[model samples]
Target chain A: MGMKCIGIDVGGTTVKVGLFETDGTLLDKWEVKSRKEEDGKYILPDVAASIREKLAGLGLDLKKDIVGAGLGVPGPVMPDGSVEVCVNLGWHHVNPQKELSGLLDGIPVKSGNDANVAALGEMWQGGGKGYSDIIMITLGTGVGGGVILDQKILSGRHGLGGEIGHIHVRDDEWEHCNCGGVGCLEQIASATGIAREARRKMAADSRDSMLRKFGDDVTAKDVLDAAKAGDELADEVFEVVARYLGLALGQAALIVDPEIFVIGGGVSRAGQFLVDRVFKYYDYFTPISKFKAKIGLATLGNDAGIYGAARLIL
Target chain B: MGMKCIGIDVGGTTVKVGLFETDGTLLDKWEVKSRKEEDGKYILPDVAASIREKLAGLGLDLKKDIVGAGLGVPGPVMPDGSVEVCVNLGWHHVNPQKELSGLLDGIPVKSGNDANVAALGEMWQGGGKGYSDIIMITLGTGVGGGVILDQKILSGRHGLGGEIGHIHVRDDEWEHCNCGGVGCLEQIASATGIAREARRKMAADSRDSMLRKFGDDVTAKDVLDAAKAGDELADEVFEVVARYLGLALGQAALIVDPEIFVIGGGVSRAGQFLVDRVFKYYDYFTPISKFKAKIGLATLGNDAGIYGAARLIL
Candidate 1:
C-alpha cells in the first residue's frame, strides 16, 4: 500500500481537502462550503465528516494507510498547533490541531499559516520547485506573504513570520489597517487597498474617461480593463500601486534576501504591466541588497493553496 | 600538544592580535600601531611577526601544535577570503587570507567581515554565548551589523548580509551615503549621522545650546553630554536618533527574528538612555512580533574583533 495522507486547506468561504500519496500526487479531492452560519463552532465536525466521506468513496481506510493529516488555516498558528487568530473565521485562541487530531482518531496533524503552506505547496509541486529560498506573495483581497528560508518555513517565534501585509510602505499617510496599523504596504498595494484608493481618488473628481463610466461600481478589474484600453488614470493608479509595492519589496529584500519572489493572487493577472512597474521602482529602493534576486509570477494559481496544504503531509 | 591558533584584527590605525585555545580562552593578547605607509600591504607581515614573537615568548612552535590562522578586516570579505572596498584602508580588493597564509609560511588562513567576526566572537565567548541566532550591531562612527542565523553567518550571496547600516529608515530624503545610497539608516541613526544632523540643525539657528559652546567641534559625545545636562535640543536629538534606530531595528526584527540583539561600539556608552529610547520605539513598530527579545550591550568590546577572527579558525 502506498503511503497516503489527507491535506485540507481552510479558506474564508470554502474548505478544500485532498488525499495525497507520499510523492505528492493528488489521489482524490473534495470541497465544502465553510460554516458561514454560526461562529464557526458548528463547522468543525462537518469538515471532518466531509473528509471521511471523501476518503470512504475512494475505498481508503483512515485507520490504516492514511498515515497523517495536514491543514492550512487562514491565520497565524501557535507553536502548539493552535489557531491564535483568524479574521475571516472569527477564531481566537482555538487549538485547531488538537481538535483535528482528536477528530481523526489521533492521527498526527500539522498546521501552519495559510500563506506559508501555499509557498511550501508551490515549492513542492509548482513554480518554486527545487528552490530552497523563496518568497511567495499572494495579492488577493489583501496581501499575504510566505517566507521559505533554508528550505524551511520561517514561522517566527510566534508563527507570525510571513505577515508581509503589515510592513509599512508609506511613512505617514497610510490607510488604517484592520490590525490597527496605518500605511501598511497591504493598505496601498493589495487588491482591496488598490480598489479603495481608486474609489477614493475617483470620488474626489470624476475626470478620468474610464473611471467616469463606472460611477459608483469602480472595481480593481475595471481599472485593469481601463489600463488595458490605455486609460491614463488607470495606468497612473497602477504606477502608484507598483511604486509602493516595489519600495516594500526593496525593504523586505533587506531582510529575507531570498533567491526569488513569487507573485500570486487575482490582481497578478495583469501580468507584465504590474510586474514591470514593480520592478522599475524596486530598483530605485534596493541600494544595499547583496544578491540579484528575480520576481516571477506564481504558476500554480488556485491549486497552490490545495497543493501547499497537501505538501504538509509529506 | 593542545590545539592553538592566532587571531588578528586589522584596523586602519591599530593592529590587535591574540593567541587563544580552541575553546576561546585567551592565552595572550597584544596591540600595536599599524603601518599605513605601505598602503596596508606590509601590515599582514607585521601582524604575522608579532604573533610569532608572542608565541616564541611562550616557547610555542607555530609549525607544530598551532592549527591555523584567522583574520578580521574592517570591510566586506570576498568569499575567497579577500577584503574588498575598505574606504578607511583604501583597499579595493586585497587577498588578506592568501597574504596572511603566505606570511605564516603556508599555515591555512581564514577571514571574514570585521563585524561578522565580532558577532562570531561574541557567540563564542561574549554576551551572545550559547545563542545560535544573534545579530550584533556596532554603534560606532557608522553602525555595523552582523547576523548569525542557525550557527552560520548570513553572508548574503554577495557578502553583504549584515549591512544594517544601510537599511532604509527615512523615506527617500537621506542624503548621499559614502556607499552611494540614500536614506540609509546609517545616514541618520549612526553616531556620525547623528552628529552631522545635530551640527546642521544647530548651525541653522544660533540657539542657546551647549552645542554652541563646543563651537564647530561638536561631536556625538558633546550631544550626549548636553542631554545628560538636560539640554532640550540634545535630548531631542537623542529622541530623533533613537526613533530612527528603533524603526530600523523593528524592521530588522520582522525578518531575522533573532533571539537577542547584542549592541556594541563607543556610542553604546550612552548606556540605558539609548537602549531605553530604542526599546520604546521598537515596541511601537513590532506590535505583531511575538518574541519581545531583549536588546543588550556587547560584552566583549574591542577584543571582540580579535576574538571573532580567532573563532574562524575553529
Candidate 2:
C-alpha cells in the first residue's frame, strides 16, 4: 500500500477531511464538527486527532504512512502558511503550519485560503483542469476569485492577493459594500446581491411577475429559476447581474489574461444559461483580440476545497 | 573586469542599448536608428551589428566578457521569448530571442513587452527598489502598466498580461481606443488624455482661467503647472485626472495587491503633487486595511526599458 496524505477544509461550522493518494486521488473523505469556542483553540487539535484516528483505522501510522497534511482555512493565508485574522473563525495572526506541524511531530503541513484552495482544485482536476494559468470565480453568497499564474498561486506581499470580490465596478453606487465600499462587483453580482436588487425593483414597480409572488423572501436561485422559466422581470435582473459580472470580468481579463475562467459557487448552478449571457457581455467589453479565453463550469463541487488542500503539498 | 550583458530597448524610431553587470549596474548605454522598413528585417541585424561594434570598441568579446542579451519590444512577448505582431516595428510573428541568438552565434537572448520590462527595472533599482512584487503605471501619451507578482512578470496566456491601461474604466466613452475599446484608463489618465479633456471643457464652458491661453495645445504638464500656480480651471482638470488615475489604481490594488506602485512615463513628471493627489483619492476609494501598498515615482526615466530589458536575461 502506498503512503497517503491528509487534506482538511476548516469552515466555521464543520471541518472536511480527505485521505488522498500522492497523485491526488481521494481515497476517502469525511466531515467533523468544528468547535469555534475559546478563540477556536480546539479546532486544530480536533483536526489532528481526527486524522490520527482515521490513519489508525486504516492500519496506518502517523510516523511513516502519512506523509503530510494540507489545510484550507477560511481566512487570509500568508505565503509562509500563517493566517491573518479570520473574523468568521475568530482567529488572529495564527501560524497554521507551525501549530499543525507541532501537533503531528514535525510532519509537514501547508495552508491556504479556502477560496484559493478551491481554485487550485478546479485547476488541477475540474473546470480549469489541464491549464497551468487560470482564474477561478466562485459566485456564492459573495463573488470571490483566485489567480494561478505560471503554475503557481499568486500570493502577494499582504497575502490578500485573491480578494477579487472587492474590485470596484460601479462609481455611481451610493451605498457601501459589506466591506465598506460602493459598487463592488460583489454588491451586484453575488447571490445575496441578486436578491437585494430584485427586491429593490419589486419595491419600486408594481410589475405583474413571479418575483412579486415571493415578495421579500426571494433568493438568487428563485430569480435565476424565474429568469430561466422566461419571466420578464426576473430576466431583467439576470441581465443586470450578467452585465455587471461580464463587464467586471472583462476588466479583470486585461489585468491577468488567463487561458480560461472557471465559474463556480452557488450562483454558478445556473450553468450554461449564465455562462452564455456573461460571455456575450465579456466579448462586448473586451478589446478585439486574436484569441479569447473560454468560460467553463466548475466540476468538482464542494469536494474542490479538499482536493486543492491535498494539492498544496503534492 | 566583471562579465557584462547587453539590454536593447526597441522603439518605433530608435533602439536603445545598454551594458549591465550581473549585479544590475549600468556599465554603458547608447542608441541606434530603428529601421522599420522591409517588415523590420533590418532591426535585429542592426541590433546584432551594434552589439558587435560596442563589444569591439570596449576590447571585449561576445564569447567571454559579454554573457547574454535582453530586449524590450513594443509588443506582446510569448513566455518562450517569441514575439507576436509588433505594429510599431512593422513586425509580424517575430521570434526575437532565436533571431538574436542565431545572429550572435547562439549567445542567448531573452525578450519581453516594453512595459513589463520597465516594471522589472523599477522593481530592481528605481522607485519600486527593494520590492519584489510591484505594479508600474506609465502615464504617458497613453496609460500603460505592467505587473510583477511574486517577483516575476505576470505574463498572461497571450503575453498581454499586466495591460492595466486597457482595463475598461468608463462605459460612457464613445471614442474607440487604439485597441478598439471605449473608456479605457488610457483614454482619461494619459498625458494626451488630460490635455484632450481640458480642450473639450474649454470649448464648452466659459468659466475659464489660464488654460484659455494654451487653447487646444495644453499638455498634462501645462495643466499640472497651472494647478500648481493657483489656476482654478486647471485645478479642476487636475482633479478629474487625479480622480480617474486614483480610482483605477485603487481597483488594480485589489487585484494584484502588490507591495508598491511605481508611477512613471511622461505624465508622472507631475511628481509629489501627482502622487499626493492620487493617494488622497486612492485612500478615499480603498477600505482601511492593516497593510496597504505605497505609491512612488519611477526614477529610471527613459533608461528603464533598457535596464529592464537587461534584467530579462539576468
Highest-scoring model, DockQ: 2
> What's the lDDT for residue B299 in model 2?
99
- Give the DockQ (2 decimals) of all models: 0.39, 0.67
Across residues A112-139, which tens digit of lDDT does each residue of candidate 1 receive? 8889888888877776787877878888
- Candidate 2 TM-score over all chains jointly: 0.97
Q: Candidate 2 — what's its lDDT?
A: 0.86
Could you give candidate 2's per-residue lDDT for residues A170-194 as a string of tens digits? Answer: 8767888877878888988889999
Kindly report which residue pairs in candidate 2 clash with one another.
A177-A181
- Can you write out model 2's per-residue Cα lDDT over B102-221, one digit (the tens) per residue? 999788798889999999889887888889889999998877789887667877887778888888878667888888888888888898889988897788779968989998788888
Q: In angstroms, give how far residue B73 of model 2 lies from its true place.
A: 0.7
CA lDDT, every model vs. true structure? 0.78, 0.86
The ten-residue window of minimal lDDT in model 1 chain A covers A284-293
| Clash tally, candidates in order | 2, 1
